[model samples]
Target: MTDTSTSSVPESTADATAAEPEATTAEETADGGTERPAADNKDLFRESEIAADYVEGLLDILDYDGDIDELTQGGRPVVEVVGARLQSLVGQRGATLEALQELTRLAVFRQTGTPSRLLLDVGGYRASRRKELAAVAKNAAEKVKQYGEAIKLDPMSAFERKCVHDVINALSGVESESEGVEPSRRIVVRPAS
Candidate 1:
């Protein structure tokens, strides 16, 4: 397993982790909107390193060969695994991937004592899924606009729902909202009033 760092390494992961909690405290801004200090790049990079190490260990135990990339993207730690014959890690509808991501986040939290917003992607599944979800959102929006009625989408994961919501929000004439609970949560698109 190879680890790649996209940002400058901190003097110590421990030092970065220790300073994270204080930076996360919410404070009122001039406009009355609550704001929190942006996570330091070093801290975020350390999170990616931790997550990558955890994932590397799992791959070793499973005897899988893959290249792991660790980096920070959009203010969150991201780990991407790219290789052949890794479909099992991705699982059906990315269920296993999501589970693994949560496990990786837990590993980071155990060491840092702070929750991590870590994104783990296997075999480019998320990128392709995002495109598919965008098409689904556009189709649903079209149906709602034409029929002047609501269109209910199938149950989806939070990531999938967010993708759909993004597309719906970018388009006109339709609005979207999520309803139901986990494992059954879905998005509904309706003609904007």
Candidate 2:
């Protein structure tokens, strides 16, 4: 039987989902048989499919309209929901979006019996946030280089800290480190020397 749920979704979303590689694995199975790498790719795509369905259901329940795109990037499943007037789901600094992403990950885990490194984007929020965080990271790195001292930034999520760390590590005269605990964990930029 064919699934009719996607009938209402936009054609762009359908195309995006179709564009992902089928899942397959490269490891040997318990039966001493080599599994195809395509299996892993298919698994990742399946995770995206599950995540997309969950997110679509959520949008429907909330009376929100969006074009959902499910695809794999950087070896991980990514689901993107794009639409107008969807800011409420994104919340302040995308806190709500983060929560929803975790929920979708859990859903994938429950279905696939494997933990998912799924990334969910709502209303292009993550892309915008990444750009903003990159700028913040550069500024912090600059401050460290100019002051010749350690600079502690405001606490940020793990993803945000990673962004800053990547920027600082790429620079010549500065390094970045994470300190403190969750919700309070932040990045510290220090002179390389």
Candidate 3:
């Protein structure tokens, strides 16, 4: 799966769910799953703890403080930092946040020796932007169905394009593909092959 750092596919696995801090240590199951002290999944929370520690170090270096909440949602580690004046952390359509999330995940990978599915949110920007992009994707799908002409969205980050691709693919009459290169890459919706 593409690393859409600011995104969630919205299926909360039974193996993992959301939670706040104040955790109890856990051990691995015979099936290689981590058992949670709480009803929530421990593996995801474990990943989030690792991620939060990494982010907290960066925060200390930058002298920034916010509420860091680590939870496992959608079978992934989600770390949310919420506070004032952090929109710059999001960059233009969250490009900077995505890069930071990648870097942070790399930090986790170094520690665990396995790639992580970490979702980093600073501010509530991603939720808001996702709604806006869903609308855009819906509109584009309607256009594709109506005219049968190819429609290309403006250059978007990889995450944004993935959101668009999912929306278009779910519709009946059209399909989507990413074309071009980073910083100028985009999505194209067309008749299904």
Q: Candidate 2: misplaced stretches above 4 Å? A: 1-39
lDDT score at residue 37, model 2, on the 0-100 scale? 38
What TM-score does each of the candidates earn?
Answer: 0.80, 0.78, 0.73
lDDT of 2 by residue, 58-144 (tens): 999999999999999866789999999899988766667767877898999999987677878888887887777778777766766
Candidate 3 per-residue lDDT over residues 13-113, each given as its tens digit = 12121221222111211111243344346766877999999988988887876889998876678899998767777776565687678788888888878
The TM-score between candidate 2 and the true structure equals 0.78
lDDT of each: 0.72, 0.66, 0.64
Predicted structure with the largest lDDT when compared to the true one = 1
Q: For every model in order, what is the number of clashing pairs?
A: 0, 13, 0
The sequence of per-residue lDDT tens digits that candidate 1 reaches over residues 49-103 is: 9999999999999999999999998777899999998999988777688779879
* Candidate with maximal TM-score: 1
Model 2: weakest 10-residue lDDT segment is: 12-21
Candidate closer to the true structure by lDDT (higher is better), 1 or 3: 1
Q: Who is ahead in TM-score, 2 or 3?
A: 2
Candidate 1 local distance difference test against the native: 0.72
